[model samples]
Target: MSFYTSLNGLKNAQTDLGVISNNIANAETNGFKKSTVAFSDIIAGSAFTNPKLMLGIGATVEAINQNFAQGPVEQTGAALDLVVNGDGFFTTRSAISGDTLYTRNGAFEVDDNGYILRGGNRLQAFPTDAAGVVSGNTLQSVQVPPTNASGAQFAGVAVGKNGVITASYADGTNVAVGKIALATFLSPGGLRQEGSANWSATGLSGTATYGEPDSGFYGGILSGALERSNVDLSEEMVGLITAQRNFQANAKAIDTATQISQTIINLRT
Candidate 1:
C-alpha cells in the first residue's frame, strides 16, 4: 500500500514538472499563457467504510489551469504589431477549413493579395461601407487597399483605439478597411487551447460575443505593440524545485517501504 501510494505521488510530481517545464520553455513566446497544475487526493475507501478509517491512497492531477492574466506590452514600432489593453481576443480564421480561432497574438502581416494574415490564417474584421465606415455585426477577412491600382507601394496600416483599421495611401488619403472585431467569452478560462497560441470556443466557454474594442465589454486595441508571454521565470523555477523535492521524497518513501517489506518477508521465512 505504501509503495503504491508513494508511486502515485511521484507520478503526480512528474505531471506537475511537465507543466512547469512547458511554461518555462514558452517564457519568451509572444501571447503565451502560463499553466498551473491542480491536484486532488485519492482516498481508499468503500461506501460502507467508516470515514475515520479511510486512508489516503495517493494524489492525482485534477486539472491544468492556464493563467490568462494580461502580459506586459512591448513596443515593437511595427505598424501591424498589436495588443489589447484589456479583455478581448483577436478573431482569426483558418484558411483551409474556415474554422474560427481566437488568439492574443496580434502580430499580423499583409499577404501579397492584400489580405491580412497570421501564419496563413486570415484575420477577421467587420466590413466597412464606401464612406470608410465600419458596419457592425459582421465579419470578413481583413483586406488592405492598395495605394494605387498598380499595387506598387505598401499602404500604411493604422489601427485606432476603437479597433478601426484604416489604410493610408501614398496620396494622403485614408480608406477605412474595417473595424477589427474583438471576441469575449463569459468564461474565458473555459476556452480550449489550440496550438500556435490560439484558443477555440467550447461549450464550457459559452458563445463568444463579438464587439468593437473599448466598447461595452471589449478591450481597447494597442497598435505598434505586442503582448509578451505571461510566464514568470522566477515563479516557474520555484515550482520546479518544489516538484523535484516532492519526487525525491516520494522515491525515498517507496524505497523505505520496499526495504521494510523485504525485512518482514525474511523474518517470516
Candidate 2:
C-alpha cells in the first residue's frame, strides 16, 4: 500500500513535469499561453491504528488550465501582422474544412487564393458592400468568399479596435467595409480546452457576446504586431526542478517500502 501510494505521487509529478516541459518548449511560440497542473490529495483509508490520519494515497492530477494573461506585443513590420491591444481572438476558417477556430496569434499571410490565413487556416473576413459598409453591426457573423484575383484590392477592408473594419483602395482611398467583432463569455475559464492552444465554447462559458475592438468592450487592433507567448522560461525551469525533486523523493519512499516488505518476507524464509 505504501509503495502504491508513492507510485501515485511519482505519476502526478511526472505529469506536472510534462506540462512544464511543454511550456518551456513553446516559449518562443507566438501567442502561446502556459498551462499549470493542479493536484488533489487522495486518501487511502481511515485512521484506525492511530489518532492521526494514515494518509496513504498520494496525489492525482486535477486539471490543466490555460492562463489567459496577455503576452508581450512585438512589431513585425508586416501590414497583415495583427496584435490585439487589449483582449479578443482572431477567427479563422479551416482551409480543408470550413470549420472556424479562434486564436490570439495574428501572424497571417495572404494565400494564393487571396484569403487571409494564419497558421494555415483561412481567415474569415465579413463581407461588405460596394460602399464598404460592414454588413453586420457585431450582431452578424463573418464570412469569407473565394478570392477573385481580379478583384480590386479588397475594396472593403476596415479593421476597428472594437471589431470595426474599414476597407480601402490600394491607392489610399478609404471605405467603410465592415466592423470587426469580438466575443466575450460569461465564464471564460469554463470554456472547453481543445489542443493546439485553442478553446471551444461550453455551457459554462455561455454564449459569446460580440463587440468591436477598443470601441465598446472589445480590445483595439494593432497592425504589424503580434502577441508573444506568455510562458516564462525561468519560472518553468523552477517548476521543473521542484517537480523532479518531488518525483525523486516519492521514488525513494517506494524503494524503502520495498526493502521493508522484502525483510518481512525473509523472516518466514
Candidate 3:
C-alpha cells in the first residue's frame, strides 16, 4: 500500500514536470498563457487504530490552470500587428465558413482575399464607408477582395483609436470602411482552449461583449506590434527544482519501505 502511494506521487510529479516543460517551451509563443499544475491530497481509507486521524493515500494532479497575466508588449514594424494592452480580444470571422471567433494575438496580415487573417484564420471586420467609421453596436458584414474602391486594391486601410477603419485609394483618396470589434468575456479563465492559440467561449466563460479597441475601457490598438508570452523563466526554474526534489524524496520513501519489507522476508527465511 505504501509503495502504491509512492508510485502515485511519482506519477503526479512527472505530470507536473511536463506542465513546466511545456510552459518553458512556449516562452516565446506570442499571446501564450503559462499553466500551473495544482495537486490535491488523496485520502485513502480511515485507520481503525485512530478515529481522529485518517491515512492519506497520496497527492495527485488536480487541475492545470492558465496564468492569464499580461505578457510584455512588443513592437513589430507591420501596421497590422496589434497588441491589446488590457482585457479584450480582436473579433474575427471565418472566411470560408463565415463563423465568428476572437483572439488576443493581434499579429495580423492581409491574405490573398484582401482580408485580414491571423494564424491562417480570416479576421472579420465590420464593413466601413470611405471614412472608416462604424454606425452602431451592430457589426456590418465586410467581405474580402474589397470591391468598393476604384482599383480593388488593399491600400491605406488603417484602424483608429475608436475602432474606425480608413482606407486610402490609388488616387490618394481616403475612405471610411468599418471598425474592428473587440470582445470581452465575463470570466476569461472559463474559456475553453482551442488549438492554434485560440479560445472558445463556454458556459462558465459567460457571454462575450463586443466593442471597439481603445473604446469604453478597452485598450487602444497598437499597430505594427505583437505581444510576447508572459512566462517567467526564473519562476519556472524555481518550480522545476521544487518538483524535482519532491520526486526524489518520494522515491527515497519507496526505497526505504522496500528495504524494511525485505528485512522481514529475510528474517522469516
lDDT of 3 by residue, 44-111 (tens): 56446574577788988888888788899887777778787787877766666766667778887776
Q: What is the Cα-based lDDT of residue 136 in candidate 3? A: 66
lDDT of 2 by residue, 77-130 (tens): 776678878767666667677666667788766565545667677655445664
Residues forming the 10-long window of minimal summed lDDT in candidate 1? 146-155
Ranking by TM-score: 1, 3, 2
Candidate 1 structure quality by residue, lDDT tens digits, 96-213? 9989999999999889889988998899998887445776677999988666454545548888888888887766666788888899899888899998899999998999999888
Give all TM-scores, in the order shown: 0.95, 0.83, 0.88
Q: Which candidate number has the best lDDT?
A: 1
Whose lDDT is higher: candidate 2's or candidate 3's? 3
Clashes of 1: 0
What's the lDDT for all of these models? 0.89, 0.71, 0.77
